[model samples]
Each structure stands twice: as C-alpha cells, then as structure tokens.
Target: MMRMFLAAAPAVLLALSSAQAEPVAYEFDLSHTEVSASWVHQGYSRQSLQFTDFDGTLDLDLETPANSTVDITFNLISGIWAGAHHEAFVGHLNSGDFFDTAVSPTAHFVGTSFETEDGETGVMTGDLTMNGQTHPVSLEVTLNNSGETRDGRSKLGFTATGTLLRSQWDMGYAVPYVSDEIDLFISTEMAVPAPAE
Candidate 1:
C-alpha cells in the first residue's frame, strides 16, 4: 500500500495543480490610447495635437512578468498642428521637408529588451521606424499597473517618453525657429490579445 501511494503522488499533484489554474489575458484598448511628439521652437516648445491613428498590443504574463513586450504604431499623416488648419505647415511636414508622411504614413516601435529601475521605471530598447528610417531608440518607460477585471478583461497601463534628434533621421527642417530636439510622449491603456485573424 505504501509503494502504491508513493507512485500515485506525482499524478495527484499534477491534477490538483492543473485544476486550480485559470487563464489570464490582458488587452490594450487603443481607443483610450494617446501618442504624441513634441519639439522645441526658439524658446518655446510645441506638441503635435493630431494623429491619424494609433495601434498597440500587449501580451503579459503575470507569473513570468519579465516575458512581456510592447508593440506601438503611429500614423504620421494624422499629426495635427495649428489646429490642423495650417495648410503650409501640413504641406511642408509631408513634403520630404520633415515627416514625408505621404511616402511613409506609419511609424512603429517594437521593444526587444527592458530593464527596471527605481521600482517601476526603466528604459526599453526598441526599433523606432520613422521617415522610412530605422533606428535603435531607447525610451524611458513607466508601468503603472496590470490586472484582471470583473468584466473578463485583463488590462495594462503605461507611460513612455523619449527624445530624438531630428537631423539624425533626415527630419531636419525649421530655419532658425524650431529646435532640433524632439520628444515623444505616449500614454497607453492596452488590452491583452493575440494577433488579429
């Protein structure tokens, strides 16, 4: 009897463990998403108030928290400056002078690595594609929280900021007014989801 009980112990443990497990998934609801870029001009800084669209996806594992990633997309054509009424500004920004949004209407960020610092804040290394140029961009990230809700939705929220030089990406424009330093501000609330079918 002792030998038989020992033999069945492993199987019993596995069954109990499997029975107690519940699947957890979180998603990013892009409707609550925000993506913006800003640059200094002379002595003042201004931000672009418009974007065509933004899309993102986050797959998180709470147990294995380190195995997570962020994928973000931006619509260059949707950038609105001057309340979107400045045709010259829009024309200049899209005409290879700055963004060249006509040729490349979208930009993307894919995080390849992450490191935490001072608790929840840290840096994320990723590829940021803009103006048809790909560069390794490091951005400061802040992860607020993540959890499963009563509505059967698991979600995550975060804020990320980064700075870039316009001249590096051939995005240089602005004569003596606008500064070369560009800052990106992104606040996101995302749902956990697999790829779209």
Candidate 2:
C-alpha cells in the first residue's frame, strides 16, 4: 500500500496543479483588429482581402497553455478587396463563385487544441466553417506583446497566420488561374473587462 501511494503521488500533484489553473477571459478590441487574407492571382501577383466585421473571445490559461480556447465569427459579406477593381472584386467574392454570402453569410472558427513553446509562439488547431462547409485548420501564432492598460485592464496582443485551400470549401472559383490556396492573417488586441464593483 505504501509503495503504491508513493508511485501515485506525482500524478495526484499534477492533477491538483492543473485544477488550480484558471483561464483568463478576453474580449477582442474590434477597432484594432484585422482578419485578412491574400492569394496569388493568376500566378502573377498577390491580391489581399479583409473582413470588415468580426468578433471573438479568447480564454488564456497561463498555467496550462494547452487549456486555452478561442471562438470567432466573421461576416462573410463584409469582405473587401484592396485594389482598383474593388467593387467588382467584392461582388464576385460574395457570389456563388466564392462565399455565396446569400446562403452563408457567416463563418466561424472554434479552437480544439492549443500548444505553445516558451508561452509566446504557438499553434492553434480548430474547425473553420465557411460557405456552409467545415474543415480542420491550424494557425501559427505569436504573442507580440501583452500588458495592463493605463486603467488596469488586462490586455494581450497577438498575430496569427494560416492557409486553406478554397476548393475544400467548394469554392474552387478560378482554380489554378486565380489560385486555390488562400493565406489568412489576423492581428488584434484583446482586453479583459474589469469586474463589477
């Protein structure tokens, strides 16, 4: 009995430590956030697009980083292409050729797993739902900076990048000519609201 207890001690301690770790909740700062993408156009130039509206929540567990979570939603029709043919580009993106925003106006991402090295560089895996389709995706993230605001609100800043094949979502569009792979990039600041007085 004594030997068995000794052997189980470490596991019990680990469980206790994990149970004591709590995740910090954060609200995204929409005004300073950008969820954007880019891709090679006709194998000649790169074109960029940005989602005009998006919101999300993040739970960061400093003690056990893998316990972190992120949930986000994007307005599909809000995508804006940055070029001279902006209006035409946006219209095409919202049509059946791409997102088909009429039937699927919203896209979402819910993180399933998270891991970090040195608590600053990390990879988050999640299911990305777009145009009524869902696929597993991974984002490489870096904690650029973090601190408390002047008013004592906790803040975190980070940037993440990922890539997805548009064809996987039935959005083949122009395929090889327009490029099937889309690169995603997100940079934002999040703040934790102060507790009620």
Candidate 3:
C-alpha cells in the first residue's frame, strides 16, 4: 500500500499544477477604455454618446475560452453628448424621461456564459441593469490583440458591440423620434496585475 501511494503522488501533483493554469484574472486599463452608444435621430442622422467613467473586470481562460467571464459598471450620469446641442441634449438624456441619472446613477453588466465563434471572435451573454431594470443581453466580442507590454505586463484588447431596445429598460423617452434601438460599443484594454509578494 505504501509503494502504491508513493507512485501516484507525482501524477497527483502534476494534475493540480495544470488545473491552476486556468482562469487568469485581469484588470481593465481605464485610461484606454471607451464605451459608446448611438441611435437614429428622427431618421435624419445617428447621434452618438459616450460614457466617460466606468470600471470592469475580466477573467480569461485562454485554453478554455468558454470558461471566461466579464463584469462592468458604468456611470449613467457620465453620458456625454458631443453635439452642437451638447448641453441641451445631455440634459435631456439625464432627465427623468431618458436615463434618469439622478435616480439611477449606475448601469451594470455581468457575463454569465461565453462562446467562441472562431479563434478570436466570441459572444458573451450577460445581464444588463439600467434605469433600475435588468435584462439579458448578448454582446459580440472580438480580441484584437494580446501580448506582453514593454513593462512586462500581459495585456489584451478587445472590442464589443451589442444592440438593445431602450424601452426595455424603461428609458424610452421618445421611441420613434429618438429611436428605441440603441447600438452600443465598447473598446477596452486589460492587463494582468502583478503577483503578490
């Protein structure tokens, strides 16, 4: 019995080491992150707005991409409308009819599952909460680059796009006039934090 236990010890240790390689944690580089949305304005043209402040986390499993996940929180009050009618449009966006940022100041997204389309393209299904309401949303994502930076930190960059109806989240201020369908896009770079001492 002692000989059998000793012979299996090496194999057990190897298995544990391999398992530890999964699910590498990463932090978003906020300086390079951008989340923007756009929709048709009375069918004349499309208007775009960007969320200026936000943070998020990403857990990536390169070997098993399906096991990855992501979570993000965006400040609803940070919406910026860079248009000729900037102040007026921005105020309308923040008023009770639109985002109602005064009452619900934050929006969130938490990924539940991930699926790969090819090597670097994938889809993430998650729950999105906005205007005090939550609903499921799937974002199409693509890994544009992944490598080590000059400082030796591992980094990954991606762009994601998703479409959702504003009315579904109770932000339907003007359905046909402003367009209920919202096209959202996110471009972000993430880095693996240094290991602790």
Clashes of 2: 0
Sorting all predicted structures by lDDT, with the top scorer first, yields 2, 3, 1
Tens-place lDDT per residue, model 2, 6-124, is 01111111121234377767777768777778889998899887776666666666566556566777766764546675888788888998888999988877777665545566666
| Candidate 2, position 197, lDDT | 100
Worst 10 residues of 2 by lDDT: 1-10
* Order of the predicted models by TM-score, top scorer first: 2, 3, 1
In order, the Cα lDDT scores of the candidates are 0.55, 0.67, 0.65
Error of 2 at 55 (Å): 1.6
Angstrom error of the Cα, residue 63, model 1: value is: 4.2
> How does residue 32 of candidate 2 score in lDDT?
77
Candidate 1 residue lDDT tens string, 1-197: 00000011111111111232333344445476555666666767564644535555444434343454456676667644445467877777777887788788777766666665343566767777778887776667676665545565545566777777777778777745787776766666655465468
Model 3 superposed RMSD (Cα): 11.6
Query: What TM-score do all the candidates reach, one by one?
Result: 0.71, 0.82, 0.80
TM-score of 2: 0.82
Candidate that scores best on lDDT: 2
Question: Per-residue CA lDDT of candidate 3, range 10-117, in tens?
Answer: 111111123445777777676887667889999999988777766656666655544555666776676454567588878887888876889988777777766553
